[model samples]
Target: MKRIFDISMSLIALVVFCLPLLVVAVLVKLTSKGPALYWSDRIGKNNEIFRMPKFRTMRIDTPAVATHLLGDPDQFLTPIGHFLRKSSLDEIPQLWSILKGDMSIVGPRPALFNQDDLVKLRTEVGVHALTPGLTGWAQINGRDELPIPVKVDFDAYYLQNRSFLLDLKIILMTVYNVVRSKGVSH
Candidate 1:
Protein backbone atom coordinates (compact mmCIF):
# COMPACT_ATOMS: atom_id res chain seq x y z
CA MET A 1 0.00 0.00 0.00
CA LYS A 2 2.78 2.39 0.91
CA ARG A 3 4.69 1.51 -2.21
CA ILE A 4 1.66 2.14 -4.35
CA PHE A 5 1.08 5.45 -2.64
CA ASP A 6 4.72 6.38 -3.16
CA ILE A 7 4.61 5.62 -6.88
CA SER A 8 1.34 7.40 -7.40
CA MET A 9 2.38 10.45 -5.41
CA SER A 10 5.79 10.62 -7.04
CA LEU A 11 4.31 10.46 -10.52
CA ILE A 12 1.83 13.16 -9.68
CA ALA A 13 4.52 15.29 -8.11
CA LEU A 14 6.80 15.00 -11.13
CA VAL A 15 3.99 16.13 -13.35
CA VAL A 16 2.72 18.82 -11.03
CA PHE A 17 6.15 20.29 -10.42
CA CYS A 18 7.46 19.76 -13.94
CA LEU A 19 7.97 23.40 -14.84
CA PRO A 20 9.53 24.33 -11.50
CA LEU A 21 11.84 21.34 -11.71
CA LEU A 22 13.00 22.47 -15.11
CA VAL A 23 13.53 26.01 -13.89
CA VAL A 24 15.56 24.80 -10.93
CA ALA A 25 17.63 22.57 -13.17
CA VAL A 26 18.33 25.46 -15.47
CA LEU A 27 19.22 27.76 -12.61
CA VAL A 28 21.54 25.13 -11.13
CA LYS A 29 23.34 24.69 -14.43
CA LEU A 30 23.54 28.40 -15.10
CA THR A 31 24.99 29.14 -11.67
CA SER A 32 27.16 26.09 -11.05
CA LYS A 33 30.00 24.38 -12.90
CA GLY A 34 28.72 20.83 -12.33
CA PRO A 35 25.67 18.94 -13.44
CA ALA A 36 22.31 20.15 -12.22
CA LEU A 37 21.55 16.83 -10.64
CA TYR A 38 23.84 15.40 -8.02
CA TRP A 39 23.86 11.65 -7.65
CA SER A 40 24.74 10.76 -4.08
CA ASP A 41 25.50 7.34 -2.66
CA ARG A 42 22.89 6.94 0.06
CA ILE A 43 22.08 4.09 2.42
CA GLY A 44 18.73 2.57 1.60
CA LYS A 45 16.63 -0.27 2.93
CA ASN A 46 18.48 -3.05 4.76
CA ASN A 47 21.66 -0.94 4.73
CA GLU A 48 22.08 -1.30 1.00
CA ILE A 49 23.65 1.53 -0.98
CA PHE A 50 21.72 3.23 -3.77
CA ARG A 51 22.22 6.34 -5.78
CA MET A 52 19.89 9.18 -4.86
CA PRO A 53 19.40 12.24 -7.00
CA LYS A 54 19.23 15.78 -5.65
CA PHE A 55 19.53 19.13 -7.36
CA ARG A 56 23.12 20.23 -6.88
CA THR A 57 23.20 22.85 -4.13
CA MET A 58 26.96 22.93 -3.66
CA ARG A 59 29.79 23.67 -6.04
CA ILE A 60 31.83 20.99 -7.86
CA ASP A 61 34.78 21.77 -5.62
CA THR A 62 32.91 21.19 -2.41
CA PRO A 63 34.14 18.28 -0.32
CA ALA A 64 31.94 15.18 -0.50
CA VAL A 65 31.13 15.32 3.18
CA ALA A 66 27.91 16.22 4.91
CA THR A 67 27.25 19.93 4.75
CA HIS A 68 27.21 20.19 8.54
CA LEU A 69 30.77 18.92 8.68
CA LEU A 70 32.15 21.39 6.20
CA GLY A 71 33.96 24.33 7.70
CA ASP A 72 32.46 27.47 6.20
CA PRO A 73 30.08 25.42 4.10
CA ASP A 74 28.55 28.52 2.58
CA GLN A 75 31.88 29.26 0.91
CA PHE A 76 31.25 26.32 -1.43
CA LEU A 77 27.78 27.40 -2.40
CA THR A 78 27.19 28.35 -5.98
CA PRO A 79 25.40 31.68 -6.50
CA ILE A 80 21.93 30.20 -6.01
CA GLY A 81 22.90 27.34 -3.71
CA HIS A 82 21.81 29.09 -0.55
CA PHE A 83 18.37 29.77 -1.96
CA LEU A 84 18.07 26.21 -3.21
CA ARG A 85 18.98 24.72 0.15
CA LYS A 86 16.90 27.11 2.21
CA SER A 87 13.85 26.66 -0.01
CA SER A 88 14.34 22.89 -0.31
CA LEU A 89 14.25 23.21 -4.08
CA ASP A 90 17.38 21.07 -4.17
CA GLU A 91 15.31 18.05 -3.14
CA ILE A 92 12.95 18.06 -6.10
CA PRO A 93 14.98 15.53 -8.09
CA GLN A 94 14.52 12.97 -5.32
CA LEU A 95 11.14 12.23 -6.85
CA TRP A 96 13.16 10.01 -9.17
CA SER A 97 14.31 7.94 -6.22
CA ILE A 98 10.71 7.61 -5.09
CA LEU A 99 9.70 6.36 -8.53
CA LYS A 100 12.58 3.87 -8.56
CA GLY A 101 11.57 2.31 -5.21
CA ASP A 102 14.89 3.21 -3.66
CA MET A 103 12.91 5.46 -1.33
CA SER A 104 9.45 6.07 0.03
CA ILE A 105 7.64 9.39 0.41
CA VAL A 106 7.79 8.95 4.18
CA GLY A 107 10.48 7.10 6.10
CA PRO A 108 13.80 7.71 7.73
CA ARG A 109 16.02 10.12 5.80
CA PRO A 110 18.70 8.21 3.89
CA ALA A 111 22.12 8.31 5.47
CA LEU A 112 25.18 9.36 3.50
CA PHE A 113 27.27 6.38 2.41
CA ASN A 114 30.14 7.46 4.69
CA GLN A 115 27.94 8.08 7.74
CA ASP A 116 29.09 4.97 9.58
CA ASP A 117 27.93 6.15 12.96
CA LEU A 118 24.41 6.83 11.75
CA VAL A 119 24.27 3.55 9.84
CA LYS A 120 25.49 1.51 12.79
CA LEU A 121 23.07 3.12 15.22
CA ARG A 122 20.12 2.69 12.88
CA THR A 123 21.06 -0.91 12.15
CA GLU A 124 21.22 -1.72 15.84
CA VAL A 125 17.75 -0.29 16.30
CA GLY A 126 16.26 -1.95 13.16
CA VAL A 127 15.57 1.42 11.48
CA HIS A 128 17.86 0.35 8.64
CA ALA A 129 15.30 -2.26 7.61
CA LEU A 130 12.90 0.40 6.40
CA THR A 131 13.13 2.17 3.08
CA PRO A 132 14.64 5.64 3.20
CA GLY A 133 12.39 8.65 2.57
CA LEU A 134 12.39 12.06 1.00
CA THR A 135 10.84 13.29 4.26
CA GLY A 136 10.13 11.67 7.61
CA TRP A 137 9.32 12.11 11.27
CA ALA A 138 12.79 13.38 11.97
CA GLN A 139 12.47 15.93 9.20
CA ILE A 140 9.31 17.44 10.56
CA ASN A 141 10.53 17.26 14.12
CA GLY A 142 13.85 19.05 13.81
CA ARG A 143 15.31 18.32 10.39
CA ASP A 144 18.97 19.44 10.29
CA GLU A 145 18.68 20.64 13.87
CA LEU A 146 18.38 17.20 15.44
CA PRO A 147 21.39 15.30 16.69
CA ILE A 148 22.04 11.88 15.23
CA PRO A 149 20.84 10.00 18.29
CA VAL A 150 17.64 12.03 18.41
CA LYS A 151 17.11 11.49 14.72
CA VAL A 152 17.52 7.74 15.20
CA ASP A 153 15.00 7.76 18.01
CA PHE A 154 12.51 9.54 15.77
CA ASP A 155 13.15 7.02 13.00
CA ALA A 156 12.57 4.15 15.39
CA TYR A 157 9.36 5.77 16.52
CA TYR A 158 8.21 6.07 12.98
CA LEU A 159 9.07 2.44 12.36
CA GLN A 160 6.93 1.37 15.28
CA ASN A 161 4.00 3.71 14.58
CA ARG A 162 3.93 4.17 10.84
CA SER A 163 0.59 3.79 9.09
CA PHE A 164 -1.34 5.34 6.27
CA LEU A 165 -2.63 8.05 8.57
CA LEU A 166 0.76 8.68 10.17
CA ASP A 167 2.33 8.91 6.77
CA LEU A 168 -0.33 11.35 5.71
CA LYS A 169 0.30 13.45 8.79
CA ILE A 170 4.01 13.44 8.14
CA ILE A 171 3.50 14.49 4.54
CA LEU A 172 1.28 17.35 5.57
CA MET A 173 3.71 18.45 8.23
CA THR A 174 6.53 18.29 5.73
CA VAL A 175 4.72 20.72 3.49
CA TYR A 176 4.28 23.11 6.36
CA ASN A 177 7.86 22.72 7.46
CA VAL A 178 9.23 23.24 3.98
CA VAL A 179 7.12 26.29 3.41
CA ARG A 180 8.18 27.80 6.70
CA SER A 181 11.77 26.60 6.38
CA LYS A 182 11.52 25.55 9.96
CA GLY A 183 14.21 23.63 11.79
CA VAL A 184 16.55 23.67 8.81
CA SER A 185 20.17 24.40 9.67
CA HIS A 186 21.21 25.20 6.11
Candidate 2:
Protein backbone atom coordinates (compact mmCIF):
# COMPACT_ATOMS: atom_id res chain seq x y z
CA MET A 1 0.00 0.00 0.00
CA LYS A 2 2.77 2.44 0.83
CA ARG A 3 4.59 1.67 -2.39
CA ILE A 4 1.43 2.19 -4.38
CA PHE A 5 0.76 5.50 -2.67
CA ASP A 6 4.33 6.65 -3.21
CA ILE A 7 4.17 5.87 -6.94
CA SER A 8 0.79 7.50 -7.41
CA MET A 9 1.65 10.63 -5.49
CA SER A 10 5.05 10.97 -7.11
CA LEU A 11 3.52 10.66 -10.59
CA ILE A 12 0.85 13.25 -9.83
CA ALA A 13 3.38 15.62 -8.27
CA LEU A 14 5.71 15.27 -11.24
CA VAL A 15 2.89 16.17 -13.60
CA VAL A 16 1.64 19.03 -11.45
CA PHE A 17 5.08 20.53 -10.87
CA CYS A 18 6.35 20.01 -14.42
CA LEU A 19 6.44 23.71 -15.26
CA PRO A 20 8.12 24.72 -12.00
CA LEU A 21 10.68 21.97 -12.44
CA LEU A 22 11.60 23.22 -15.88
CA VAL A 23 11.87 26.79 -14.68
CA VAL A 24 14.11 25.78 -11.79
CA ALA A 25 16.27 23.77 -14.12
CA VAL A 26 16.70 26.74 -16.43
CA LEU A 27 17.49 29.04 -13.52
CA VAL A 28 20.01 26.60 -12.09
CA LYS A 29 21.78 26.30 -15.42
CA LEU A 30 21.87 30.04 -15.95
CA THR A 31 23.14 30.75 -12.45
CA SER A 32 25.66 27.95 -12.11
CA LYS A 33 28.57 26.47 -14.04
CA GLY A 34 27.61 22.84 -13.48
CA PRO A 35 24.71 20.70 -14.50
CA ALA A 36 21.31 21.77 -13.20
CA LEU A 37 20.98 18.52 -11.31
CA TYR A 38 23.47 17.25 -8.75
CA TRP A 39 23.60 13.50 -8.41
CA SER A 40 24.58 12.85 -4.79
CA ASP A 41 25.58 9.49 -3.41
CA ARG A 42 23.15 8.82 -0.57
CA ILE A 43 22.73 5.96 1.87
CA GLY A 44 19.34 4.39 1.30
CA LYS A 45 17.35 1.48 2.71
CA ASN A 46 19.37 -1.16 4.51
CA ASN A 47 22.49 1.02 4.22
CA GLU A 48 22.72 0.62 0.47
CA ILE A 49 24.07 3.48 -1.59
CA PHE A 50 21.98 5.11 -4.31
CA ARG A 51 22.26 8.21 -6.41
CA MET A 52 19.87 10.99 -5.50
CA PRO A 53 19.33 13.98 -7.72
CA LYS A 54 18.80 17.44 -6.36
CA PHE A 55 18.81 20.77 -8.15
CA ARG A 56 22.40 21.93 -7.87
CA THR A 57 22.43 24.55 -5.15
CA MET A 58 26.18 24.70 -4.75
CA ARG A 59 28.96 25.34 -7.23
CA ILE A 60 30.80 22.59 -9.05
CA ASP A 61 33.92 23.12 -6.95
CA THR A 62 32.15 22.96 -3.63
CA PRO A 63 33.51 20.18 -1.44
CA ALA A 64 31.35 17.06 -1.50
CA VAL A 65 30.35 17.22 2.13
CA ALA A 66 27.22 18.00 4.01
CA THR A 67 26.37 21.68 3.73
CA HIS A 68 26.45 22.00 7.49
CA LEU A 69 29.99 20.70 7.55
CA LEU A 70 31.19 23.28 5.10
CA GLY A 71 32.96 26.28 6.55
CA ASP A 72 30.87 29.24 5.43
CA PRO A 73 28.66 27.27 3.09
CA ASP A 74 27.31 30.49 1.61
CA GLN A 75 30.57 31.00 -0.23
CA PHE A 76 29.80 28.05 -2.47
CA LEU A 77 26.27 29.06 -3.38
CA THR A 78 25.55 29.86 -6.98
CA PRO A 79 23.63 33.10 -7.56
CA ILE A 80 20.21 31.59 -6.99
CA GLY A 81 21.26 28.84 -4.61
CA HIS A 82 20.06 30.55 -1.47
CA PHE A 83 16.63 31.09 -2.92
CA LEU A 84 16.46 27.49 -4.10
CA ARG A 85 17.47 26.13 -0.71
CA LYS A 86 15.23 28.46 1.27
CA SER A 87 12.21 27.73 -0.86
CA SER A 88 12.93 24.02 -0.88
CA LEU A 89 12.71 24.20 -4.66
CA ASP A 90 15.98 22.32 -4.94
CA GLU A 91 14.18 19.22 -3.75
CA ILE A 92 11.79 18.96 -6.66
CA PRO A 93 14.00 16.56 -8.56
CA GLN A 94 13.75 14.00 -5.76
CA LEU A 95 10.27 13.26 -6.96
CA TRP A 96 11.99 11.30 -9.66
CA SER A 97 13.79 9.27 -7.00
CA ILE A 98 10.51 8.53 -5.30
CA LEU A 99 9.05 7.46 -8.60
CA LYS A 100 12.10 5.30 -9.23
CA GLY A 101 11.75 3.52 -5.85
CA ASP A 102 14.95 4.86 -4.30
CA MET A 103 12.97 7.07 -1.91
CA SER A 104 9.57 7.38 -0.39
CA ILE A 105 7.56 10.57 0.16
CA VAL A 106 7.94 10.17 3.92
CA GLY A 107 10.70 8.34 5.79
CA PRO A 108 14.10 9.14 7.25
CA ARG A 109 15.95 11.57 5.04
CA PRO A 110 18.92 9.84 3.39
CA ALA A 111 22.35 10.49 4.80
CA LEU A 112 25.32 11.38 2.67
CA PHE A 113 27.41 8.38 1.68
CA ASN A 114 30.31 9.59 3.81
CA GLN A 115 28.25 10.18 6.94
CA ASP A 116 29.61 7.14 8.70
CA ASP A 117 28.54 8.19 12.18
CA LEU A 118 24.98 8.79 11.11
CA VAL A 119 24.87 5.52 9.22
CA LYS A 120 26.27 3.59 12.14
CA LEU A 121 23.88 5.10 14.66
CA ARG A 122 20.86 4.53 12.46
CA THR A 123 21.94 1.01 11.71
CA GLU A 124 22.42 0.23 15.37
CA VAL A 125 18.89 1.39 16.02
CA GLY A 126 17.55 -0.59 13.08
CA VAL A 127 16.37 2.57 11.31
CA HIS A 128 18.29 1.69 8.19
CA ALA A 129 15.88 -1.03 7.25
CA LEU A 130 13.38 1.55 6.00
CA THR A 131 13.52 3.40 2.73
CA PRO A 132 14.87 6.94 2.77
CA GLY A 133 12.49 9.83 2.13
CA LEU A 134 12.26 13.38 0.79
CA THR A 135 10.74 14.38 4.13
CA GLY A 136 10.29 12.69 7.48
CA TRP A 137 9.65 13.14 11.22
CA ALA A 138 13.14 14.49 11.78
CA GLN A 139 12.71 16.81 8.85
CA ILE A 140 9.58 18.42 10.21
CA ASN A 141 10.95 18.46 13.72
CA GLY A 142 14.23 20.33 13.25
CA ARG A 143 15.65 19.48 9.86
CA ASP A 144 19.21 20.77 9.59
CA GLU A 145 19.23 21.79 13.23
CA LEU A 146 18.82 18.33 14.72
CA PRO A 147 21.86 16.40 15.92
CA ILE A 148 22.58 13.09 14.28
CA PRO A 149 21.59 10.90 17.23
CA VAL A 150 18.33 12.82 17.63
CA LYS A 151 17.61 12.40 13.96
CA VAL A 152 18.22 8.67 14.31
CA ASP A 153 15.89 8.57 17.25
CA PHE A 154 13.17 10.18 15.21
CA ASP A 155 13.77 7.67 12.46
CA ALA A 156 13.45 4.84 14.95
CA TYR A 157 10.22 6.33 16.21
CA TYR A 158 8.86 6.37 12.73
CA LEU A 159 9.89 2.80 12.24
CA GLN A 160 7.96 1.76 15.30
CA ASN A 161 4.86 3.88 14.69
CA ARG A 162 4.58 3.96 10.93
CA SER A 163 1.05 3.75 9.64
CA PHE A 164 -0.88 5.10 6.70
CA LEU A 165 -2.31 7.86 8.83
CA LEU A 166 1.08 8.72 10.32
CA ASP A 167 2.53 8.91 6.87
CA LEU A 168 -0.29 11.17 5.79
CA LYS A 169 0.31 13.38 8.78
CA ILE A 170 3.99 13.57 8.03
CA ILE A 171 3.29 14.50 4.42
CA LEU A 172 0.89 17.23 5.44
CA MET A 173 3.32 18.61 8.01
CA THR A 174 6.09 18.54 5.43
CA VAL A 175 4.06 20.74 3.12
CA TYR A 176 3.34 23.11 5.94
CA ASN A 177 6.97 23.30 6.95
CA VAL A 178 8.10 23.82 3.41
CA VAL A 179 5.57 26.57 2.86
CA ARG A 180 6.63 28.32 6.03
CA SER A 181 10.28 27.81 5.19
CA LYS A 182 10.82 26.40 8.65
CA GLY A 183 13.61 24.19 10.00
CA VAL A 184 15.97 24.55 6.98
CA SER A 185 19.35 26.07 7.67
CA HIS A 186 20.92 25.94 4.19
Candidate 3:
Protein backbone atom coordinates (compact mmCIF):
# COMPACT_ATOMS: atom_id res chain seq x y z
CA MET A 1 0.00 0.00 0.00
CA LYS A 2 2.79 2.43 0.82
CA ARG A 3 4.57 1.55 -2.39
CA ILE A 4 1.41 2.27 -4.33
CA PHE A 5 1.00 5.52 -2.49
CA ASP A 6 4.57 6.57 -3.10
CA ILE A 7 4.38 5.64 -6.78
CA SER A 8 1.11 7.40 -7.52
CA MET A 9 2.07 10.48 -5.58
CA SER A 10 5.50 10.61 -7.12
CA LEU A 11 4.22 10.13 -10.65
CA ILE A 12 1.62 12.82 -10.33
CA ALA A 13 3.98 15.17 -8.59
CA LEU A 14 6.66 14.67 -11.23
CA VAL A 15 4.19 15.56 -13.94
CA VAL A 16 2.74 18.47 -12.03
CA PHE A 17 6.11 19.98 -11.15
CA CYS A 18 8.01 19.15 -14.30
CA LEU A 19 8.26 22.74 -15.44
CA PRO A 20 9.32 24.02 -12.05
CA LEU A 21 12.00 21.37 -11.90
CA LEU A 22 13.25 22.43 -15.29
CA VAL A 23 13.41 26.02 -14.17
CA VAL A 24 15.27 25.08 -11.02
CA ALA A 25 17.64 22.98 -13.05
CA VAL A 26 18.37 25.87 -15.36
CA LEU A 27 18.84 28.24 -12.48
CA VAL A 28 21.21 25.81 -10.79
CA LYS A 29 23.19 25.46 -13.98
CA LEU A 30 23.43 29.21 -14.39
CA THR A 31 24.50 29.78 -10.82
CA SER A 32 26.73 26.80 -10.09
CA LYS A 33 29.35 24.63 -11.74
CA GLY A 34 27.97 21.29 -10.57
CA PRO A 35 24.95 19.31 -11.70
CA ALA A 36 21.55 20.65 -10.81
CA LEU A 37 20.75 17.62 -8.67
CA TYR A 38 23.14 16.44 -6.03
CA TRP A 39 23.42 12.68 -5.76
CA SER A 40 24.66 11.59 -2.39
CA ASP A 41 25.11 7.97 -1.46
CA ARG A 42 22.76 6.94 1.33
CA ILE A 43 21.98 3.72 3.15
CA GLY A 44 18.68 1.98 2.41
CA LYS A 45 16.75 -0.96 3.83
CA ASN A 46 18.76 -4.08 4.52
CA ASN A 47 21.91 -2.00 4.38
CA GLU A 48 21.76 -1.27 0.67
CA ILE A 49 23.37 1.82 -0.79
CA PHE A 50 21.53 4.13 -3.10
CA ARG A 51 22.13 7.55 -4.57
CA MET A 52 19.60 9.99 -3.20
CA PRO A 53 18.82 13.00 -5.34
CA LYS A 54 18.21 16.45 -4.00
CA PHE A 55 18.35 19.81 -5.73
CA ARG A 56 21.78 21.30 -5.39
CA THR A 57 21.61 23.72 -2.48
CA MET A 58 25.31 24.19 -1.65
CA ARG A 59 28.47 25.16 -3.42
CA ILE A 60 30.10 22.40 -5.42
CA ASP A 61 33.35 23.14 -3.68
CA THR A 62 31.85 22.83 -0.25
CA PRO A 63 33.39 19.99 1.72
CA ALA A 64 31.90 16.63 0.77
CA VAL A 65 30.70 16.50 4.33
CA ALA A 66 27.59 17.01 6.39
CA THR A 67 26.62 20.60 7.11
CA HIS A 68 26.41 19.91 10.85
CA LEU A 69 30.16 19.46 10.85
CA LEU A 70 30.90 22.71 9.12
CA GLY A 71 31.58 26.15 10.50
CA ASP A 72 30.41 29.37 8.88
CA PRO A 73 28.27 27.24 6.58
CA ASP A 74 26.35 30.06 4.93
CA GLN A 75 29.43 30.55 2.77
CA PHE A 76 28.65 27.22 1.10
CA LEU A 77 25.30 28.11 -0.38
CA THR A 78 24.73 29.28 -3.91
CA PRO A 79 22.64 32.36 -4.61
CA ILE A 80 19.31 30.50 -4.25
CA GLY A 81 20.49 27.62 -2.15
CA HIS A 82 19.32 29.06 1.11
CA PHE A 83 15.86 29.71 -0.29
CA LEU A 84 15.57 26.19 -1.57
CA ARG A 85 16.74 24.58 1.63
CA LYS A 86 14.78 26.85 3.92
CA SER A 87 11.61 26.30 1.94
CA SER A 88 12.33 22.61 1.49
CA LEU A 89 12.09 23.11 -2.25
CA ASP A 90 15.45 21.47 -2.66
CA GLU A 91 13.93 18.09 -1.73
CA ILE A 92 11.49 18.09 -4.62
CA PRO A 93 13.75 16.00 -6.77
CA GLN A 94 13.49 13.18 -4.29
CA LEU A 95 10.12 12.41 -5.76
CA TRP A 96 12.13 10.61 -8.40
CA SER A 97 13.87 8.66 -5.73
CA ILE A 98 10.47 7.67 -4.41
CA LEU A 99 9.38 6.55 -7.83
CA LYS A 100 12.52 4.49 -8.06
CA GLY A 101 11.67 2.87 -4.73
CA ASP A 102 14.85 4.22 -3.20
CA MET A 103 12.68 6.12 -0.73
CA SER A 104 9.23 6.38 0.73
CA ILE A 105 7.03 9.34 1.63
CA VAL A 106 7.09 8.28 5.28
CA GLY A 107 9.93 6.52 7.09
CA PRO A 108 13.26 7.32 8.62
CA ARG A 109 15.57 9.69 6.83
CA PRO A 110 18.33 7.92 4.95
CA ALA A 111 21.76 8.07 6.49
CA LEU A 112 24.63 9.38 4.44
CA PHE A 113 27.05 6.68 3.41
CA ASN A 114 29.80 8.38 5.39
CA GLN A 115 27.70 8.86 8.51
CA ASP A 116 28.99 5.72 10.11
CA ASP A 117 28.01 6.64 13.65
CA LEU A 118 24.38 7.28 12.78
CA VAL A 119 24.27 4.28 10.48
CA LYS A 120 25.67 1.99 13.12
CA LEU A 121 23.30 3.33 15.70
CA ARG A 122 20.37 2.90 13.32
CA THR A 123 21.42 -0.66 12.71
CA GLU A 124 21.53 -1.42 16.40
CA VAL A 125 18.08 0.08 16.79
CA GLY A 126 16.61 -1.70 13.74
CA VAL A 127 15.96 1.63 12.04
CA HIS A 128 17.58 0.41 8.84
CA ALA A 129 15.03 -2.35 8.57
CA LEU A 130 12.69 0.09 6.86
CA THR A 131 13.20 2.09 3.70
CA PRO A 132 14.22 5.70 4.22
CA GLY A 133 11.67 8.40 3.59
CA LEU A 134 11.41 11.99 2.36
CA THR A 135 9.55 12.89 5.54
CA GLY A 136 8.79 10.89 8.61
CA TRP A 137 8.28 10.90 12.38
CA ALA A 138 11.70 12.47 12.87
CA GLN A 139 11.27 15.06 10.16
CA ILE A 140 7.87 16.31 11.31
CA ASN A 141 9.17 16.30 14.87
CA GLY A 142 12.40 18.33 14.83
CA ARG A 143 14.33 17.44 11.69
CA ASP A 144 18.02 18.23 11.92
CA GLU A 145 17.54 19.89 15.26
CA LEU A 146 17.15 16.54 16.98
CA PRO A 147 20.17 14.69 18.23
CA ILE A 148 21.09 11.46 16.48
CA PRO A 149 19.82 9.32 19.33
CA VAL A 150 16.48 11.07 19.38
CA LYS A 151 16.10 10.76 15.67
CA VAL A 152 16.93 7.08 15.87
CA ASP A 153 14.26 6.63 18.51
CA PHE A 154 11.69 8.22 16.25
CA ASP A 155 12.82 6.01 13.40
CA ALA A 156 12.34 2.97 15.53
CA TYR A 157 8.91 4.16 16.55
CA TYR A 158 7.88 4.60 12.92
CA LEU A 159 9.22 1.21 12.03
CA GLN A 160 7.22 -0.49 14.75
CA ASN A 161 3.98 1.48 14.31
CA ARG A 162 3.79 2.51 10.63
CA SER A 163 0.40 2.32 9.00
CA PHE A 164 -1.65 4.08 6.37
CA LEU A 165 -3.30 6.21 8.99
CA LEU A 166 0.01 7.07 10.64
CA ASP A 167 1.56 7.88 7.28
CA LEU A 168 -1.42 10.08 6.45
CA LYS A 169 -1.03 11.94 9.70
CA ILE A 170 2.62 12.51 8.98
CA ILE A 171 1.82 13.77 5.50
CA LEU A 172 -0.64 16.29 6.87
CA MET A 173 1.84 17.45 9.48
CA THR A 174 4.42 17.68 6.74
CA VAL A 175 2.18 20.03 4.81
CA TYR A 176 1.76 22.22 7.85
CA ASN A 177 5.47 22.12 8.60
CA VAL A 178 6.38 23.05 5.05
CA VAL A 179 3.90 25.89 4.94
CA ARG A 180 5.13 27.29 8.21
CA SER A 181 8.70 26.47 7.26
CA LYS A 182 9.18 24.99 10.69
CA GLY A 183 11.08 21.98 12.06
CA VAL A 184 14.03 22.39 9.73
CA SER A 185 17.45 23.04 11.17
CA HIS A 186 20.34 24.65 9.40
The per-model lDDT (C-alpha) reads 0.94, 0.95, 0.89
In candidate 2, what residue range of length 10 has the lowest lDDT sum? 25-34
Residue-pair clashes, model 1: 0
Candidate RMSDs in Å, in order, are 0.6, 0.6, 1.0
Q: What is candidate 1's CA lDDT for residue 12?
A: 97
**Candidate 1 global CA lDDT score:** 0.94
Clashing pairs in 1: none
> Candidate 3: where is the Cα deviation over 4 Å?
none
Residue-level lDDT tens digits of model 2 in 7-91: 9999999999999999999999987798999999999999999999999999999999999999899999999999999899999
- Identify the superior model by TM-score, candidate 2 or candidate 3: 2
- Better model by lDDT, 1 or 3? 1
Ordered by lDDT, highest first, the candidates read: 2, 1, 3
Kindly indicate the candidate among 1 and 2 with the higher lDDT.
2
Per-residue C-alpha lDDT of model 3 across residues 133-162, encoded as one tens digit per residue: 999999999988998899889998988898
Off by over 4 Å in 1: none
Candidate 3 TM-score versus the reference:
0.96
After the best TM-score superposition of candidate 1, give how far the Cα of residue 161 lies from its true spot, in angstroms. 0.6
Q: Taking the candidates one at a time, how many backbone clashes does each contain?
A: 0, 0, 0
